[model samples]
Target: MQVAYDYEYQLAVADYWQGRPTMEPNVWVPSLPLQMTVAVPASNTDLVVSSGGQQELKLAVMEESTEYQHERSNPMEDFEKAARAFEDDLQKMQTKMHLFPPSMKGEELSKYSEPKVVSIGPYHHGKGEAIPQMESTKYAAACHFINESGRSVEEVYGAVFAVADEARRCYDADKLRLLSDNDFKPMMFYDGCFLLQYMLFMCRDNNDEDHPIADLPWVVVDKLMKLMPKPGLDMETFVGRVKQCLQTRRHLKFDPPILDESYKPPHLLGLLRFYIVGSTDSSTTDDGSGQGLSDNAKKVSLSVSVIELAEMGIRLTADKTTAEINKMRVTRGWFTGKLFLPPVSLDDANARFLVNMAAFELCITPDFGEVDDTMSTVCAYLCLLGMVTDNDTDVQELRKKHILQGGGLTNEDALELFTGLEKHLRPGNCYYNTIVAIENYRSDRRLWIKLYRFGYRNQTAIIAVLTTIAGIAGFLGTLKSFQ
Candidate 1:
């Protein structure tokens, strides 16, 4: 793609313009016009099952991925979003819009960092007197005031946002420096250009010898804010959008959306990027249109993603489960390949086989994604309705009520329960969106117990059956006799 010939070079008399037949003289170098690309790194999983104890359950996280590897490298913020907010306010103020009754000079804006510039604002921020744990609430209240009354020069007593506008008139950057020098904290900035705009406002308000503005990271905030939405709307939605904006740069991003996608947290690009990737091997592709993917691949991918989620959720529920099982500490027992489940964790995750099955079973079972709570529920439900391929012995023992706690049921038991619950578990009955059905059977609990419970695939099948039956009946009456 280098310049083969420069038509301009031929027409130009100057030697400087001499080049290939139809390109500029500088066009033939070690580069091409930049093109976009998606970046994907391979997945890595390390597994260990210990008997006496888990020697290496802990693994440190990887370093942050900064790869700009995207199909499009658009900056998170467009041009207009990067423009200063308060500075825009200042311009209007000069035209008698009165953002301030008395104007603050550009030099006065620099002294905002002084520490001595403390506040006893128009309202008590609480206490006789140091405020505690009420920053965001107070900040929001102040913002509302500024939006309403900052324009009215005649207004003296008003909300913090309006008065804050006037406070900026006497701002000093030096006082902000004292706040930073003394290590003042709880200093957060709005995500986008608001940080710089806020900085200018604070700098102009220096009624002290210290500068709090010096401590805030205006530059980094400035960079990130471009992608952030304007603040007039809701905070919750805005936070989620900021997360997605940064996540557009991650490696694990997939085109196909998952049924149960993880919630993207605000500004955590690192974790969000890793969330979407599946552990399944993509290096090789099978035409899995008919029979679907091999069992091994499904297990591997599902296990990794699910385990990642469980690790987050288990903090409250699984701590006891882990501690109870760990007491046995059968290191040598691990080689025998038995993953025994407590009656509790079994129900919690529906006894996923990888964790409970022996190494011998592990060899037979495909490496699906980690046994997440949802997947386990789905699997357990299938086993109950006889949809799962086979029966399990340990589960049967539970259904027999041999355990300390009862309410255990087998797959058939679950089916009967769901069938009995048809009316009770219908659309707004037991839950939202989830279809109630009995997937498996437990010996102790009555079948009706599961009638109002949830099932994913079974309900889907039920809908499909009804649709098919309706179609068949409609067509049968229309056919000619023996035709």
Candidate 2:
């Protein structure tokens, strides 16, 4: 009998050999009378089948294909999972209080960026050697805060616990895996209450006998005061005072607008950043047309130093309109230009405050949509200061214009601080616009600036030449008269 090898026959054969029943009963035979003889040759084995007469049968060898097929999966489901993960990451980035980035992790930068007296959020909490000393203070402040609110401790703590899960999402998951809800809830509650009480203590008169500050150690008070505003000031004045103390404002001539009652901050440091940088609305600059700069406008670059600007007939002045960092701009006249900068007072406290704020900005992901500017307002302001200040002489010039106010920092210190900070700052829209305006002014008066810079550089030689020429003309006139 001759058998044709086909797909069905191959499948049947495979199923029979594998001990699997075939789907078609008629296709498989359980018992068939047959005789088979196998012959082993040098190159291959041969099988001969004989019923009445012997017949030789040859087996065809098949090569296996090296391809594979996987089970089908739902693409939409995978896409949705990926999209959800991406959104979660963005939310975490926006709401989370982040630690200093690797770039800002050196001993010098970390000293200011990390909390020295106390840790406010999960990022720094329980990590520092000195932080444990403030645990008692936090408890005391929480107790005071609860009493001041006229709420029971359980009620206040329950409120924090209710939002505890939401708050936990703001911190890194790896850091929080070891922290249980039992430990985390109290942390948020105590930290929140302590921060509120601290702010209240800073803004109100300190004579209250039951105040948290009264119980705090003198060393702690001194350190805390460095990060806080002076006591006995109203809310607006308190904001301005803190802004000045932190060197957040170019000048404290104008008070910041009162924080809205509806506004909520992520943490204590966030609240301080708000007080320093002001609201996003206040930070947004308005051109005469009430529109922001075009993309092209924000790409402009400025390289001139403060001294070079002065030589080009451009002077630095403090912006008295507002304490917002975005208030920086340049104005031009027919013969001169003026760069208006927000005034700032630099000191140890201010340096710490500024560095922390800059680090906060650095930690924030650009996808947060917190502001239209490409960089944070504080960082942009620092970058602008860095651009104009190259040396101690530039700091002196800034002080002369009252743009740099009196602080514990000397001119050299201020220069070093700005130089250290500006490297970490990316240009924001405000800084870029200021640069655009300055560049435009420089370009418009290119010829005049060039001539002025040349004349200014060679002024002594030019004056000496003029004096010699005058003497030569006078002697020639005298000689002619004698002749």
Candidate 3:
């Protein structure tokens, strides 16, 4: 810790004898590792910077990139501002509008990937609740990335279900029931997403029962029937890729194994068109990049009935613009001078909300229903707000496709953050109705059938006889007392 005074004297003498250039005082002193009692400025010059915990030293010369800094435009800041604007506008316009309906169209909507649906294997270890727990920075980054990137139409997204499967759980019993039902897959756009089943578990009344629906009948997308070859990697291989991400700070070398194009779902196109491509901030910016779309944009929706393939459904309707689409039909060897107009006029914001809601419904279908109270309330709002269509196949398909398995927040997350979830001071948060739904489900007949199933007939008859005898005895006693 102690430095000899002779060292400083020797250095001064050497500098004088050699007639060497003076060393910059601001540069780190060679006396750095020493302990100091009386504080001496590191630099002889007034301008100095503070060292780790020591006094700032003065330096006439500075190292590169040390002092001056440059300013750069933050694309993320721009995106966040835009997103906030959108949220504000939507809240102002959509607050009072009902978005979820109790009962929606229930007809079987067709799918483009019909032939290739694969049944998830029995060994499928369902995942936990997929509640997004992103911090502010991460949220901004995700929003920025999504807003700036191009949509990928055919790629299957990967979302590992946690053991709790929080993605799909709702607070309403009816919604929970609808979601957990095995037969509801057809209601969804795809055979439901990764945590679709698990969300059902999260939304279930766990407090009342271990509500993961203990006995499940595995009904899956029949992929083998659809002509798609299986991915070479199984769960073990997929886990290995996950391991790589954990092992290194960089991106994993292993990419998701590509599946055959033949088996890709047609809904994937619509997914890309709307979710991935539709709302990007950069796309709408005037960058001459063909990234932005007009406020009003329409996506093509295709539907085929499992019961009747000929009865096809398309999300787009025929209107004057239809003529425009027809005008460009020369490639099909068809001459069309008319325009292709959509039935729903997307010029207005309300119309866009309606269409987007419809698309959401189509994609989110039988995928979620009979959900928990919280989720049920959300779905109900979607209906009450008129975002979802009335009871029918096409309408039902839309609900299944869009809303139920809503990805970002699972039922538990909704419950945990239930107090803080709403960012606004507006009334009628979807959570209120969810509680009502839970109370209602508790009284349902099925809740106690198992426990009271023992000797039902005999017990009922005996109670009935005892009640009659007691009534007669009371009548006789009253008469005697009157006498």
lDDT of each: 0.26, 0.60, 0.26
Question: What's the best-to-worst order under lDDT?
Answer: 2, 3, 1
Per-candidate TM-score against the hidden true structure: 0.15, 0.67, 0.17
- The lowest-lDDT stretch of 10 consecutive residues in candidate 3 is 324-333
* Candidate 2 Cα misplacement greater than 4 A, ranges: 1-80, 127-129, 205-241, 244-256, 261-264, 278-302, 365-371, 410-412, 462-483
**Clashes per candidate (backbone, < 3 Å):** 84, 5, 98
Residue 169 displacement (Å), model 2:
1.6
What does candidate 2's lDDT look like per residue over 359-395, in tens digits?
7677764632446653467777887788888888888
Q: Tens digits of per-residue lDDT for model 1 on 161-257?
A: 2223333232234434333211121122111222333333333322111111122222233333332335532323322332222121222432322
TM-score of 2: 0.67
Best by TM-score: 2
Using lDDT as the measure, which candidate wins?
Answer: 2
The digit string of per-residue lDDT tens for model 3 on 196-304 reads: 3222223333211111111111111122112122331142233223222211122324443333334322222121122211111221011221222223323211211
- The root-mean-square deviation over C-alpha atoms between each candidate and the true structure, in angstroms, is 31.9, 22.2, 27.0
The positional error of residue 12 in candidate 2, measured at the CA in angstroms, is 86
**Clash pairs (backbone) in predicted model 2:** 249-343, 250-342, 250-343, 250-344, 251-343
TM-score of 3: 0.17
